[model samples]
Target: MAASSSRSFAEVQRRVSGVHRGTDPEQQLRFYDGWAPEYEQDVTILHYQAPRLAASCLASAIQGPLADALVLDVACGTGLVAQELQAKGFCRFHGLDGSQGMLESARRKGLYQELKQCVLGQEALPASSGFYDAVLIVGALSEGQVPTSVVPELLRVAKPGGFLCLTTRSNRSNLRYKSQMQQLLDDLEQRGLWEKVKVQEVERWERATSEQEAMEGSDYISGVVYLYRKAQTVGF
Candidate 1:
């Protein structure tokens, strides 16, 4: 990669990260809603793969009827995960996102059966307990996004023996947040809420890299995805 290209990518990363620099959820919503129009392009530029990689990982381990399985897609931005999962044979879907703009984009795809707007970590998840056959979230478990406290909520919404998959970036900026989330996951498992199924660290997860690692041709990001199954009986 040329020095000029590296510099250009770094600038893009800076602007993107700046949009969600604060803890104010409303401001972040506005930024994300406005970014909906160009969200795919920007993620493409960054080589985002949480959607596809997570879909593939879950799809491979899926059981029962694929065409009839109910899925709750948390933070279903632009329905990218829906698209990927649709390709893998899942039909029913419910999408949840905080950004109405992003929900509109996802709605246009005609993939989800329902779409709801809820600010994660701040608001209660608008789903019944043990309702979804698969409850999955991606790209929203990192810094400046959802908090680690929602781990139990995600598990609560998933049916007993159902799967819950989530992904988080494994980069310098998100390492601390990742640690907190991991501890929550472990705590949930200990309490017999869920059981760990699989964990994968995907290399070259995305491109365009990060501002902290800006260098010529150094544009591949890495992330980890975790899969778990809700316990059939809590505290049993």
Candidate 2:
């Protein structure tokens, strides 16, 4: 599929809405496969900033040398997260996404040292435990995408004192899922798995794409970026 130079908001929203309508991971994968060519363009049209926001938080929270750190980019569609981190001096990255087409697009950027295919929430992350200096998942932790259960898996892959950064929209549609995700994050902190590092909430996450949001007269919706540090000693 060739990329289109011009993409209208209606077309972009329709594509986004189509992906959201997918009922299962396989279906979503198919949607993303077809969407890979224009994914960047569409998100650009939306002024999507989750990748940038999550990368900023991760960069700020990391403790050691950025170049040497092995960062795991989960649900890393088209290498957007890596692009942002690369701009911040982070060099090493391993990416994982379910869509082969999406991975192919990411591969062209030459940002990731490794790229694997895994359906998040349905499959275990294909990486060694306690290896990465930082792990991140952005724009994929909402109601229909990755479940909160995979958060522990993110922590499991990070080295002690490493950081795990995540982002989710806080718009009206995602409030319930966000609440559940936050509860799990809080529970993990209490369980000695990780400690809270930062929670940055932005009012202009992206231009509103849904009709309901437009009807409400809001130009942009809200979102959040969460950063956590893995404990030095984690028990299970």
Candidate 3:
């Protein structure tokens, strides 16, 4: 029993290390393309918990209904959360990510009215300013995945009063990443870029029913969620 437990802990640590190492845009795109098909399946059996929890936390942050609203799913990956939003009644939807291969899988879902390839951190938003009513970013905030610099750009494209919701793995104990994200949010708030509306951390757990599922789910290291809202214009 002791030997088995030690092996399990080591496997979990290895997977966590891989995610913490981060990846460049090109590498991320390539990785996602190769990972798209297996990604959803793996998430469904083992990885579904985080995205579902994050999306639920996001939904709770909004104040009003989103029936007629236009939403942007940044780094949408395979549109997992976008599909969830749509099913909940959001009509107009757009999904943007750097991985064409991932987008290919998202396109098949027939959810987004628009789907574009965007390299996070460097790629300019394809839409015009104030075009979306809300922007939902799930599993995007990280060290190498998305630079802190992108927060301002995200605020720029959202309409005043619109939502700019995002989730980042909780790094409260990791001062470096925590300070990086806090500073980014502070800069945006100081510039009147967006209002600090809601910020919360959620814990996530994964359980596996099969050996294959257990192997894939074993990779998740730390899981937490954060959200923010873009301030509405003063006087309407």
Candidate 4:
């Protein structure tokens, strides 16, 4: 694993654990609620354009109108991608997240058919196994309050032969953190749970506005998108 000046994996792990320690969902909700108004602004200032690119990538990869498919959007922060999906005619959209503020923002968009408030790692999904035809997770694999255990849970809820699409920062940027994501993919493949369908690196570029001259610097970030298809059957 390559070294990163960014937060250490252990440090991120500790933070995630601490966020859930209080056992009060409202505490988590308040944190995201505080972040909602500025969330998009902060990400844009930071050049976090992966979500839009990931949404486009997923929109192109899906076989048909997502309207016909039951879809789940995990950790759907501000419903950016969910809004995109809905715009593309996907009607049965279900969004799940731990932050009440995020869900509030999502609800305001009127994109989701159903919204559930629960932590991704701890909350059990309301659906049965193999219930959804597609699952889209964009920009949720990074540190900062994301649960590492949610990966397997995603696969567990997806139906056989369903599609699971994920996007995250590239391995080149942070190998240790990227390795954690790779491990999730590898484990799913090894268990005959999913088959690799597409993998690509996406680059996003942003230019500073006149008002934000001081923020002009390196204007691009590298990210990766991985799309996998769950197998029709798994052998024990």
Specify the highest-TM-score model's number.
Answer: 2
Off by over 4 Å in 4: 1-29, 171-174, 205-217
lDDT of 4: 0.68
User: Which tens-of-lDDT digit does each residue in 1-236 have in candidate 4?
Assistant: 01123444344333333332333445666766777765655554455565566566666777876678888998888888776666666678899887777888788888788888766666776667878888878776654445557777777778888888887664233445668878979987987789998887765522222222222243444568888888898431
Q: lDDT score of model 2?
A: 0.88
Question: TM-score, each model?
Answer: 0.91, 0.95, 0.78, 0.76
TM-score winner, 2 or 4: 2
Rank order (by TM-score, best first): 2, 1, 3, 4
* Residues 1-236, model 3: lDDT tens digits: 00112224334434334444566778766767877765665555444455566566656666677677888888888888777776566767899989898899889889899999988788778888777778877776766677777776777778788777776654432336657878888877886767776666544444433343233335433455556667676222
Q: Give the TM-score comparing model 1 with the true structure, all chains together.
A: 0.91
Worst 10 residues of 2 by lDDT: 209-218
Task: Estimate the lDDT of model 3.
Answer: 0.67
How displaced is residue 212 in candidate 3, in Å?
A: 21
lDDT of 2 by residue, 1-236 (tens): 12345989999888887755527888888888999999998988898889988888888777668898899999998999999999999999999999999999999999899999999998788987899899999998987888888998999889988899999888777788999999999999988889998999998898888866542557898899999999999853
Q: Per-residue error at 142 for model 3, in Å?
A: 0.9
lDDT agreement with native, every candidate: 0.83, 0.88, 0.67, 0.68
lDDT string, candidate 1, 1-236, tens digits = 00122335555676587653656778888888987877776776676789888898888878877887899999998899999999899989999999999999999999999999999998779999889889889998878887777778888888888899999987767778889989989988887788999999987877634557443455676789999998998532
Q: Top model by lDDT, which number? A: 2
Q: Which stretches of candidate 1 lie over 4 Å from their true place?
A: 1-11, 214-217
lDDT of 4 at 91: 75
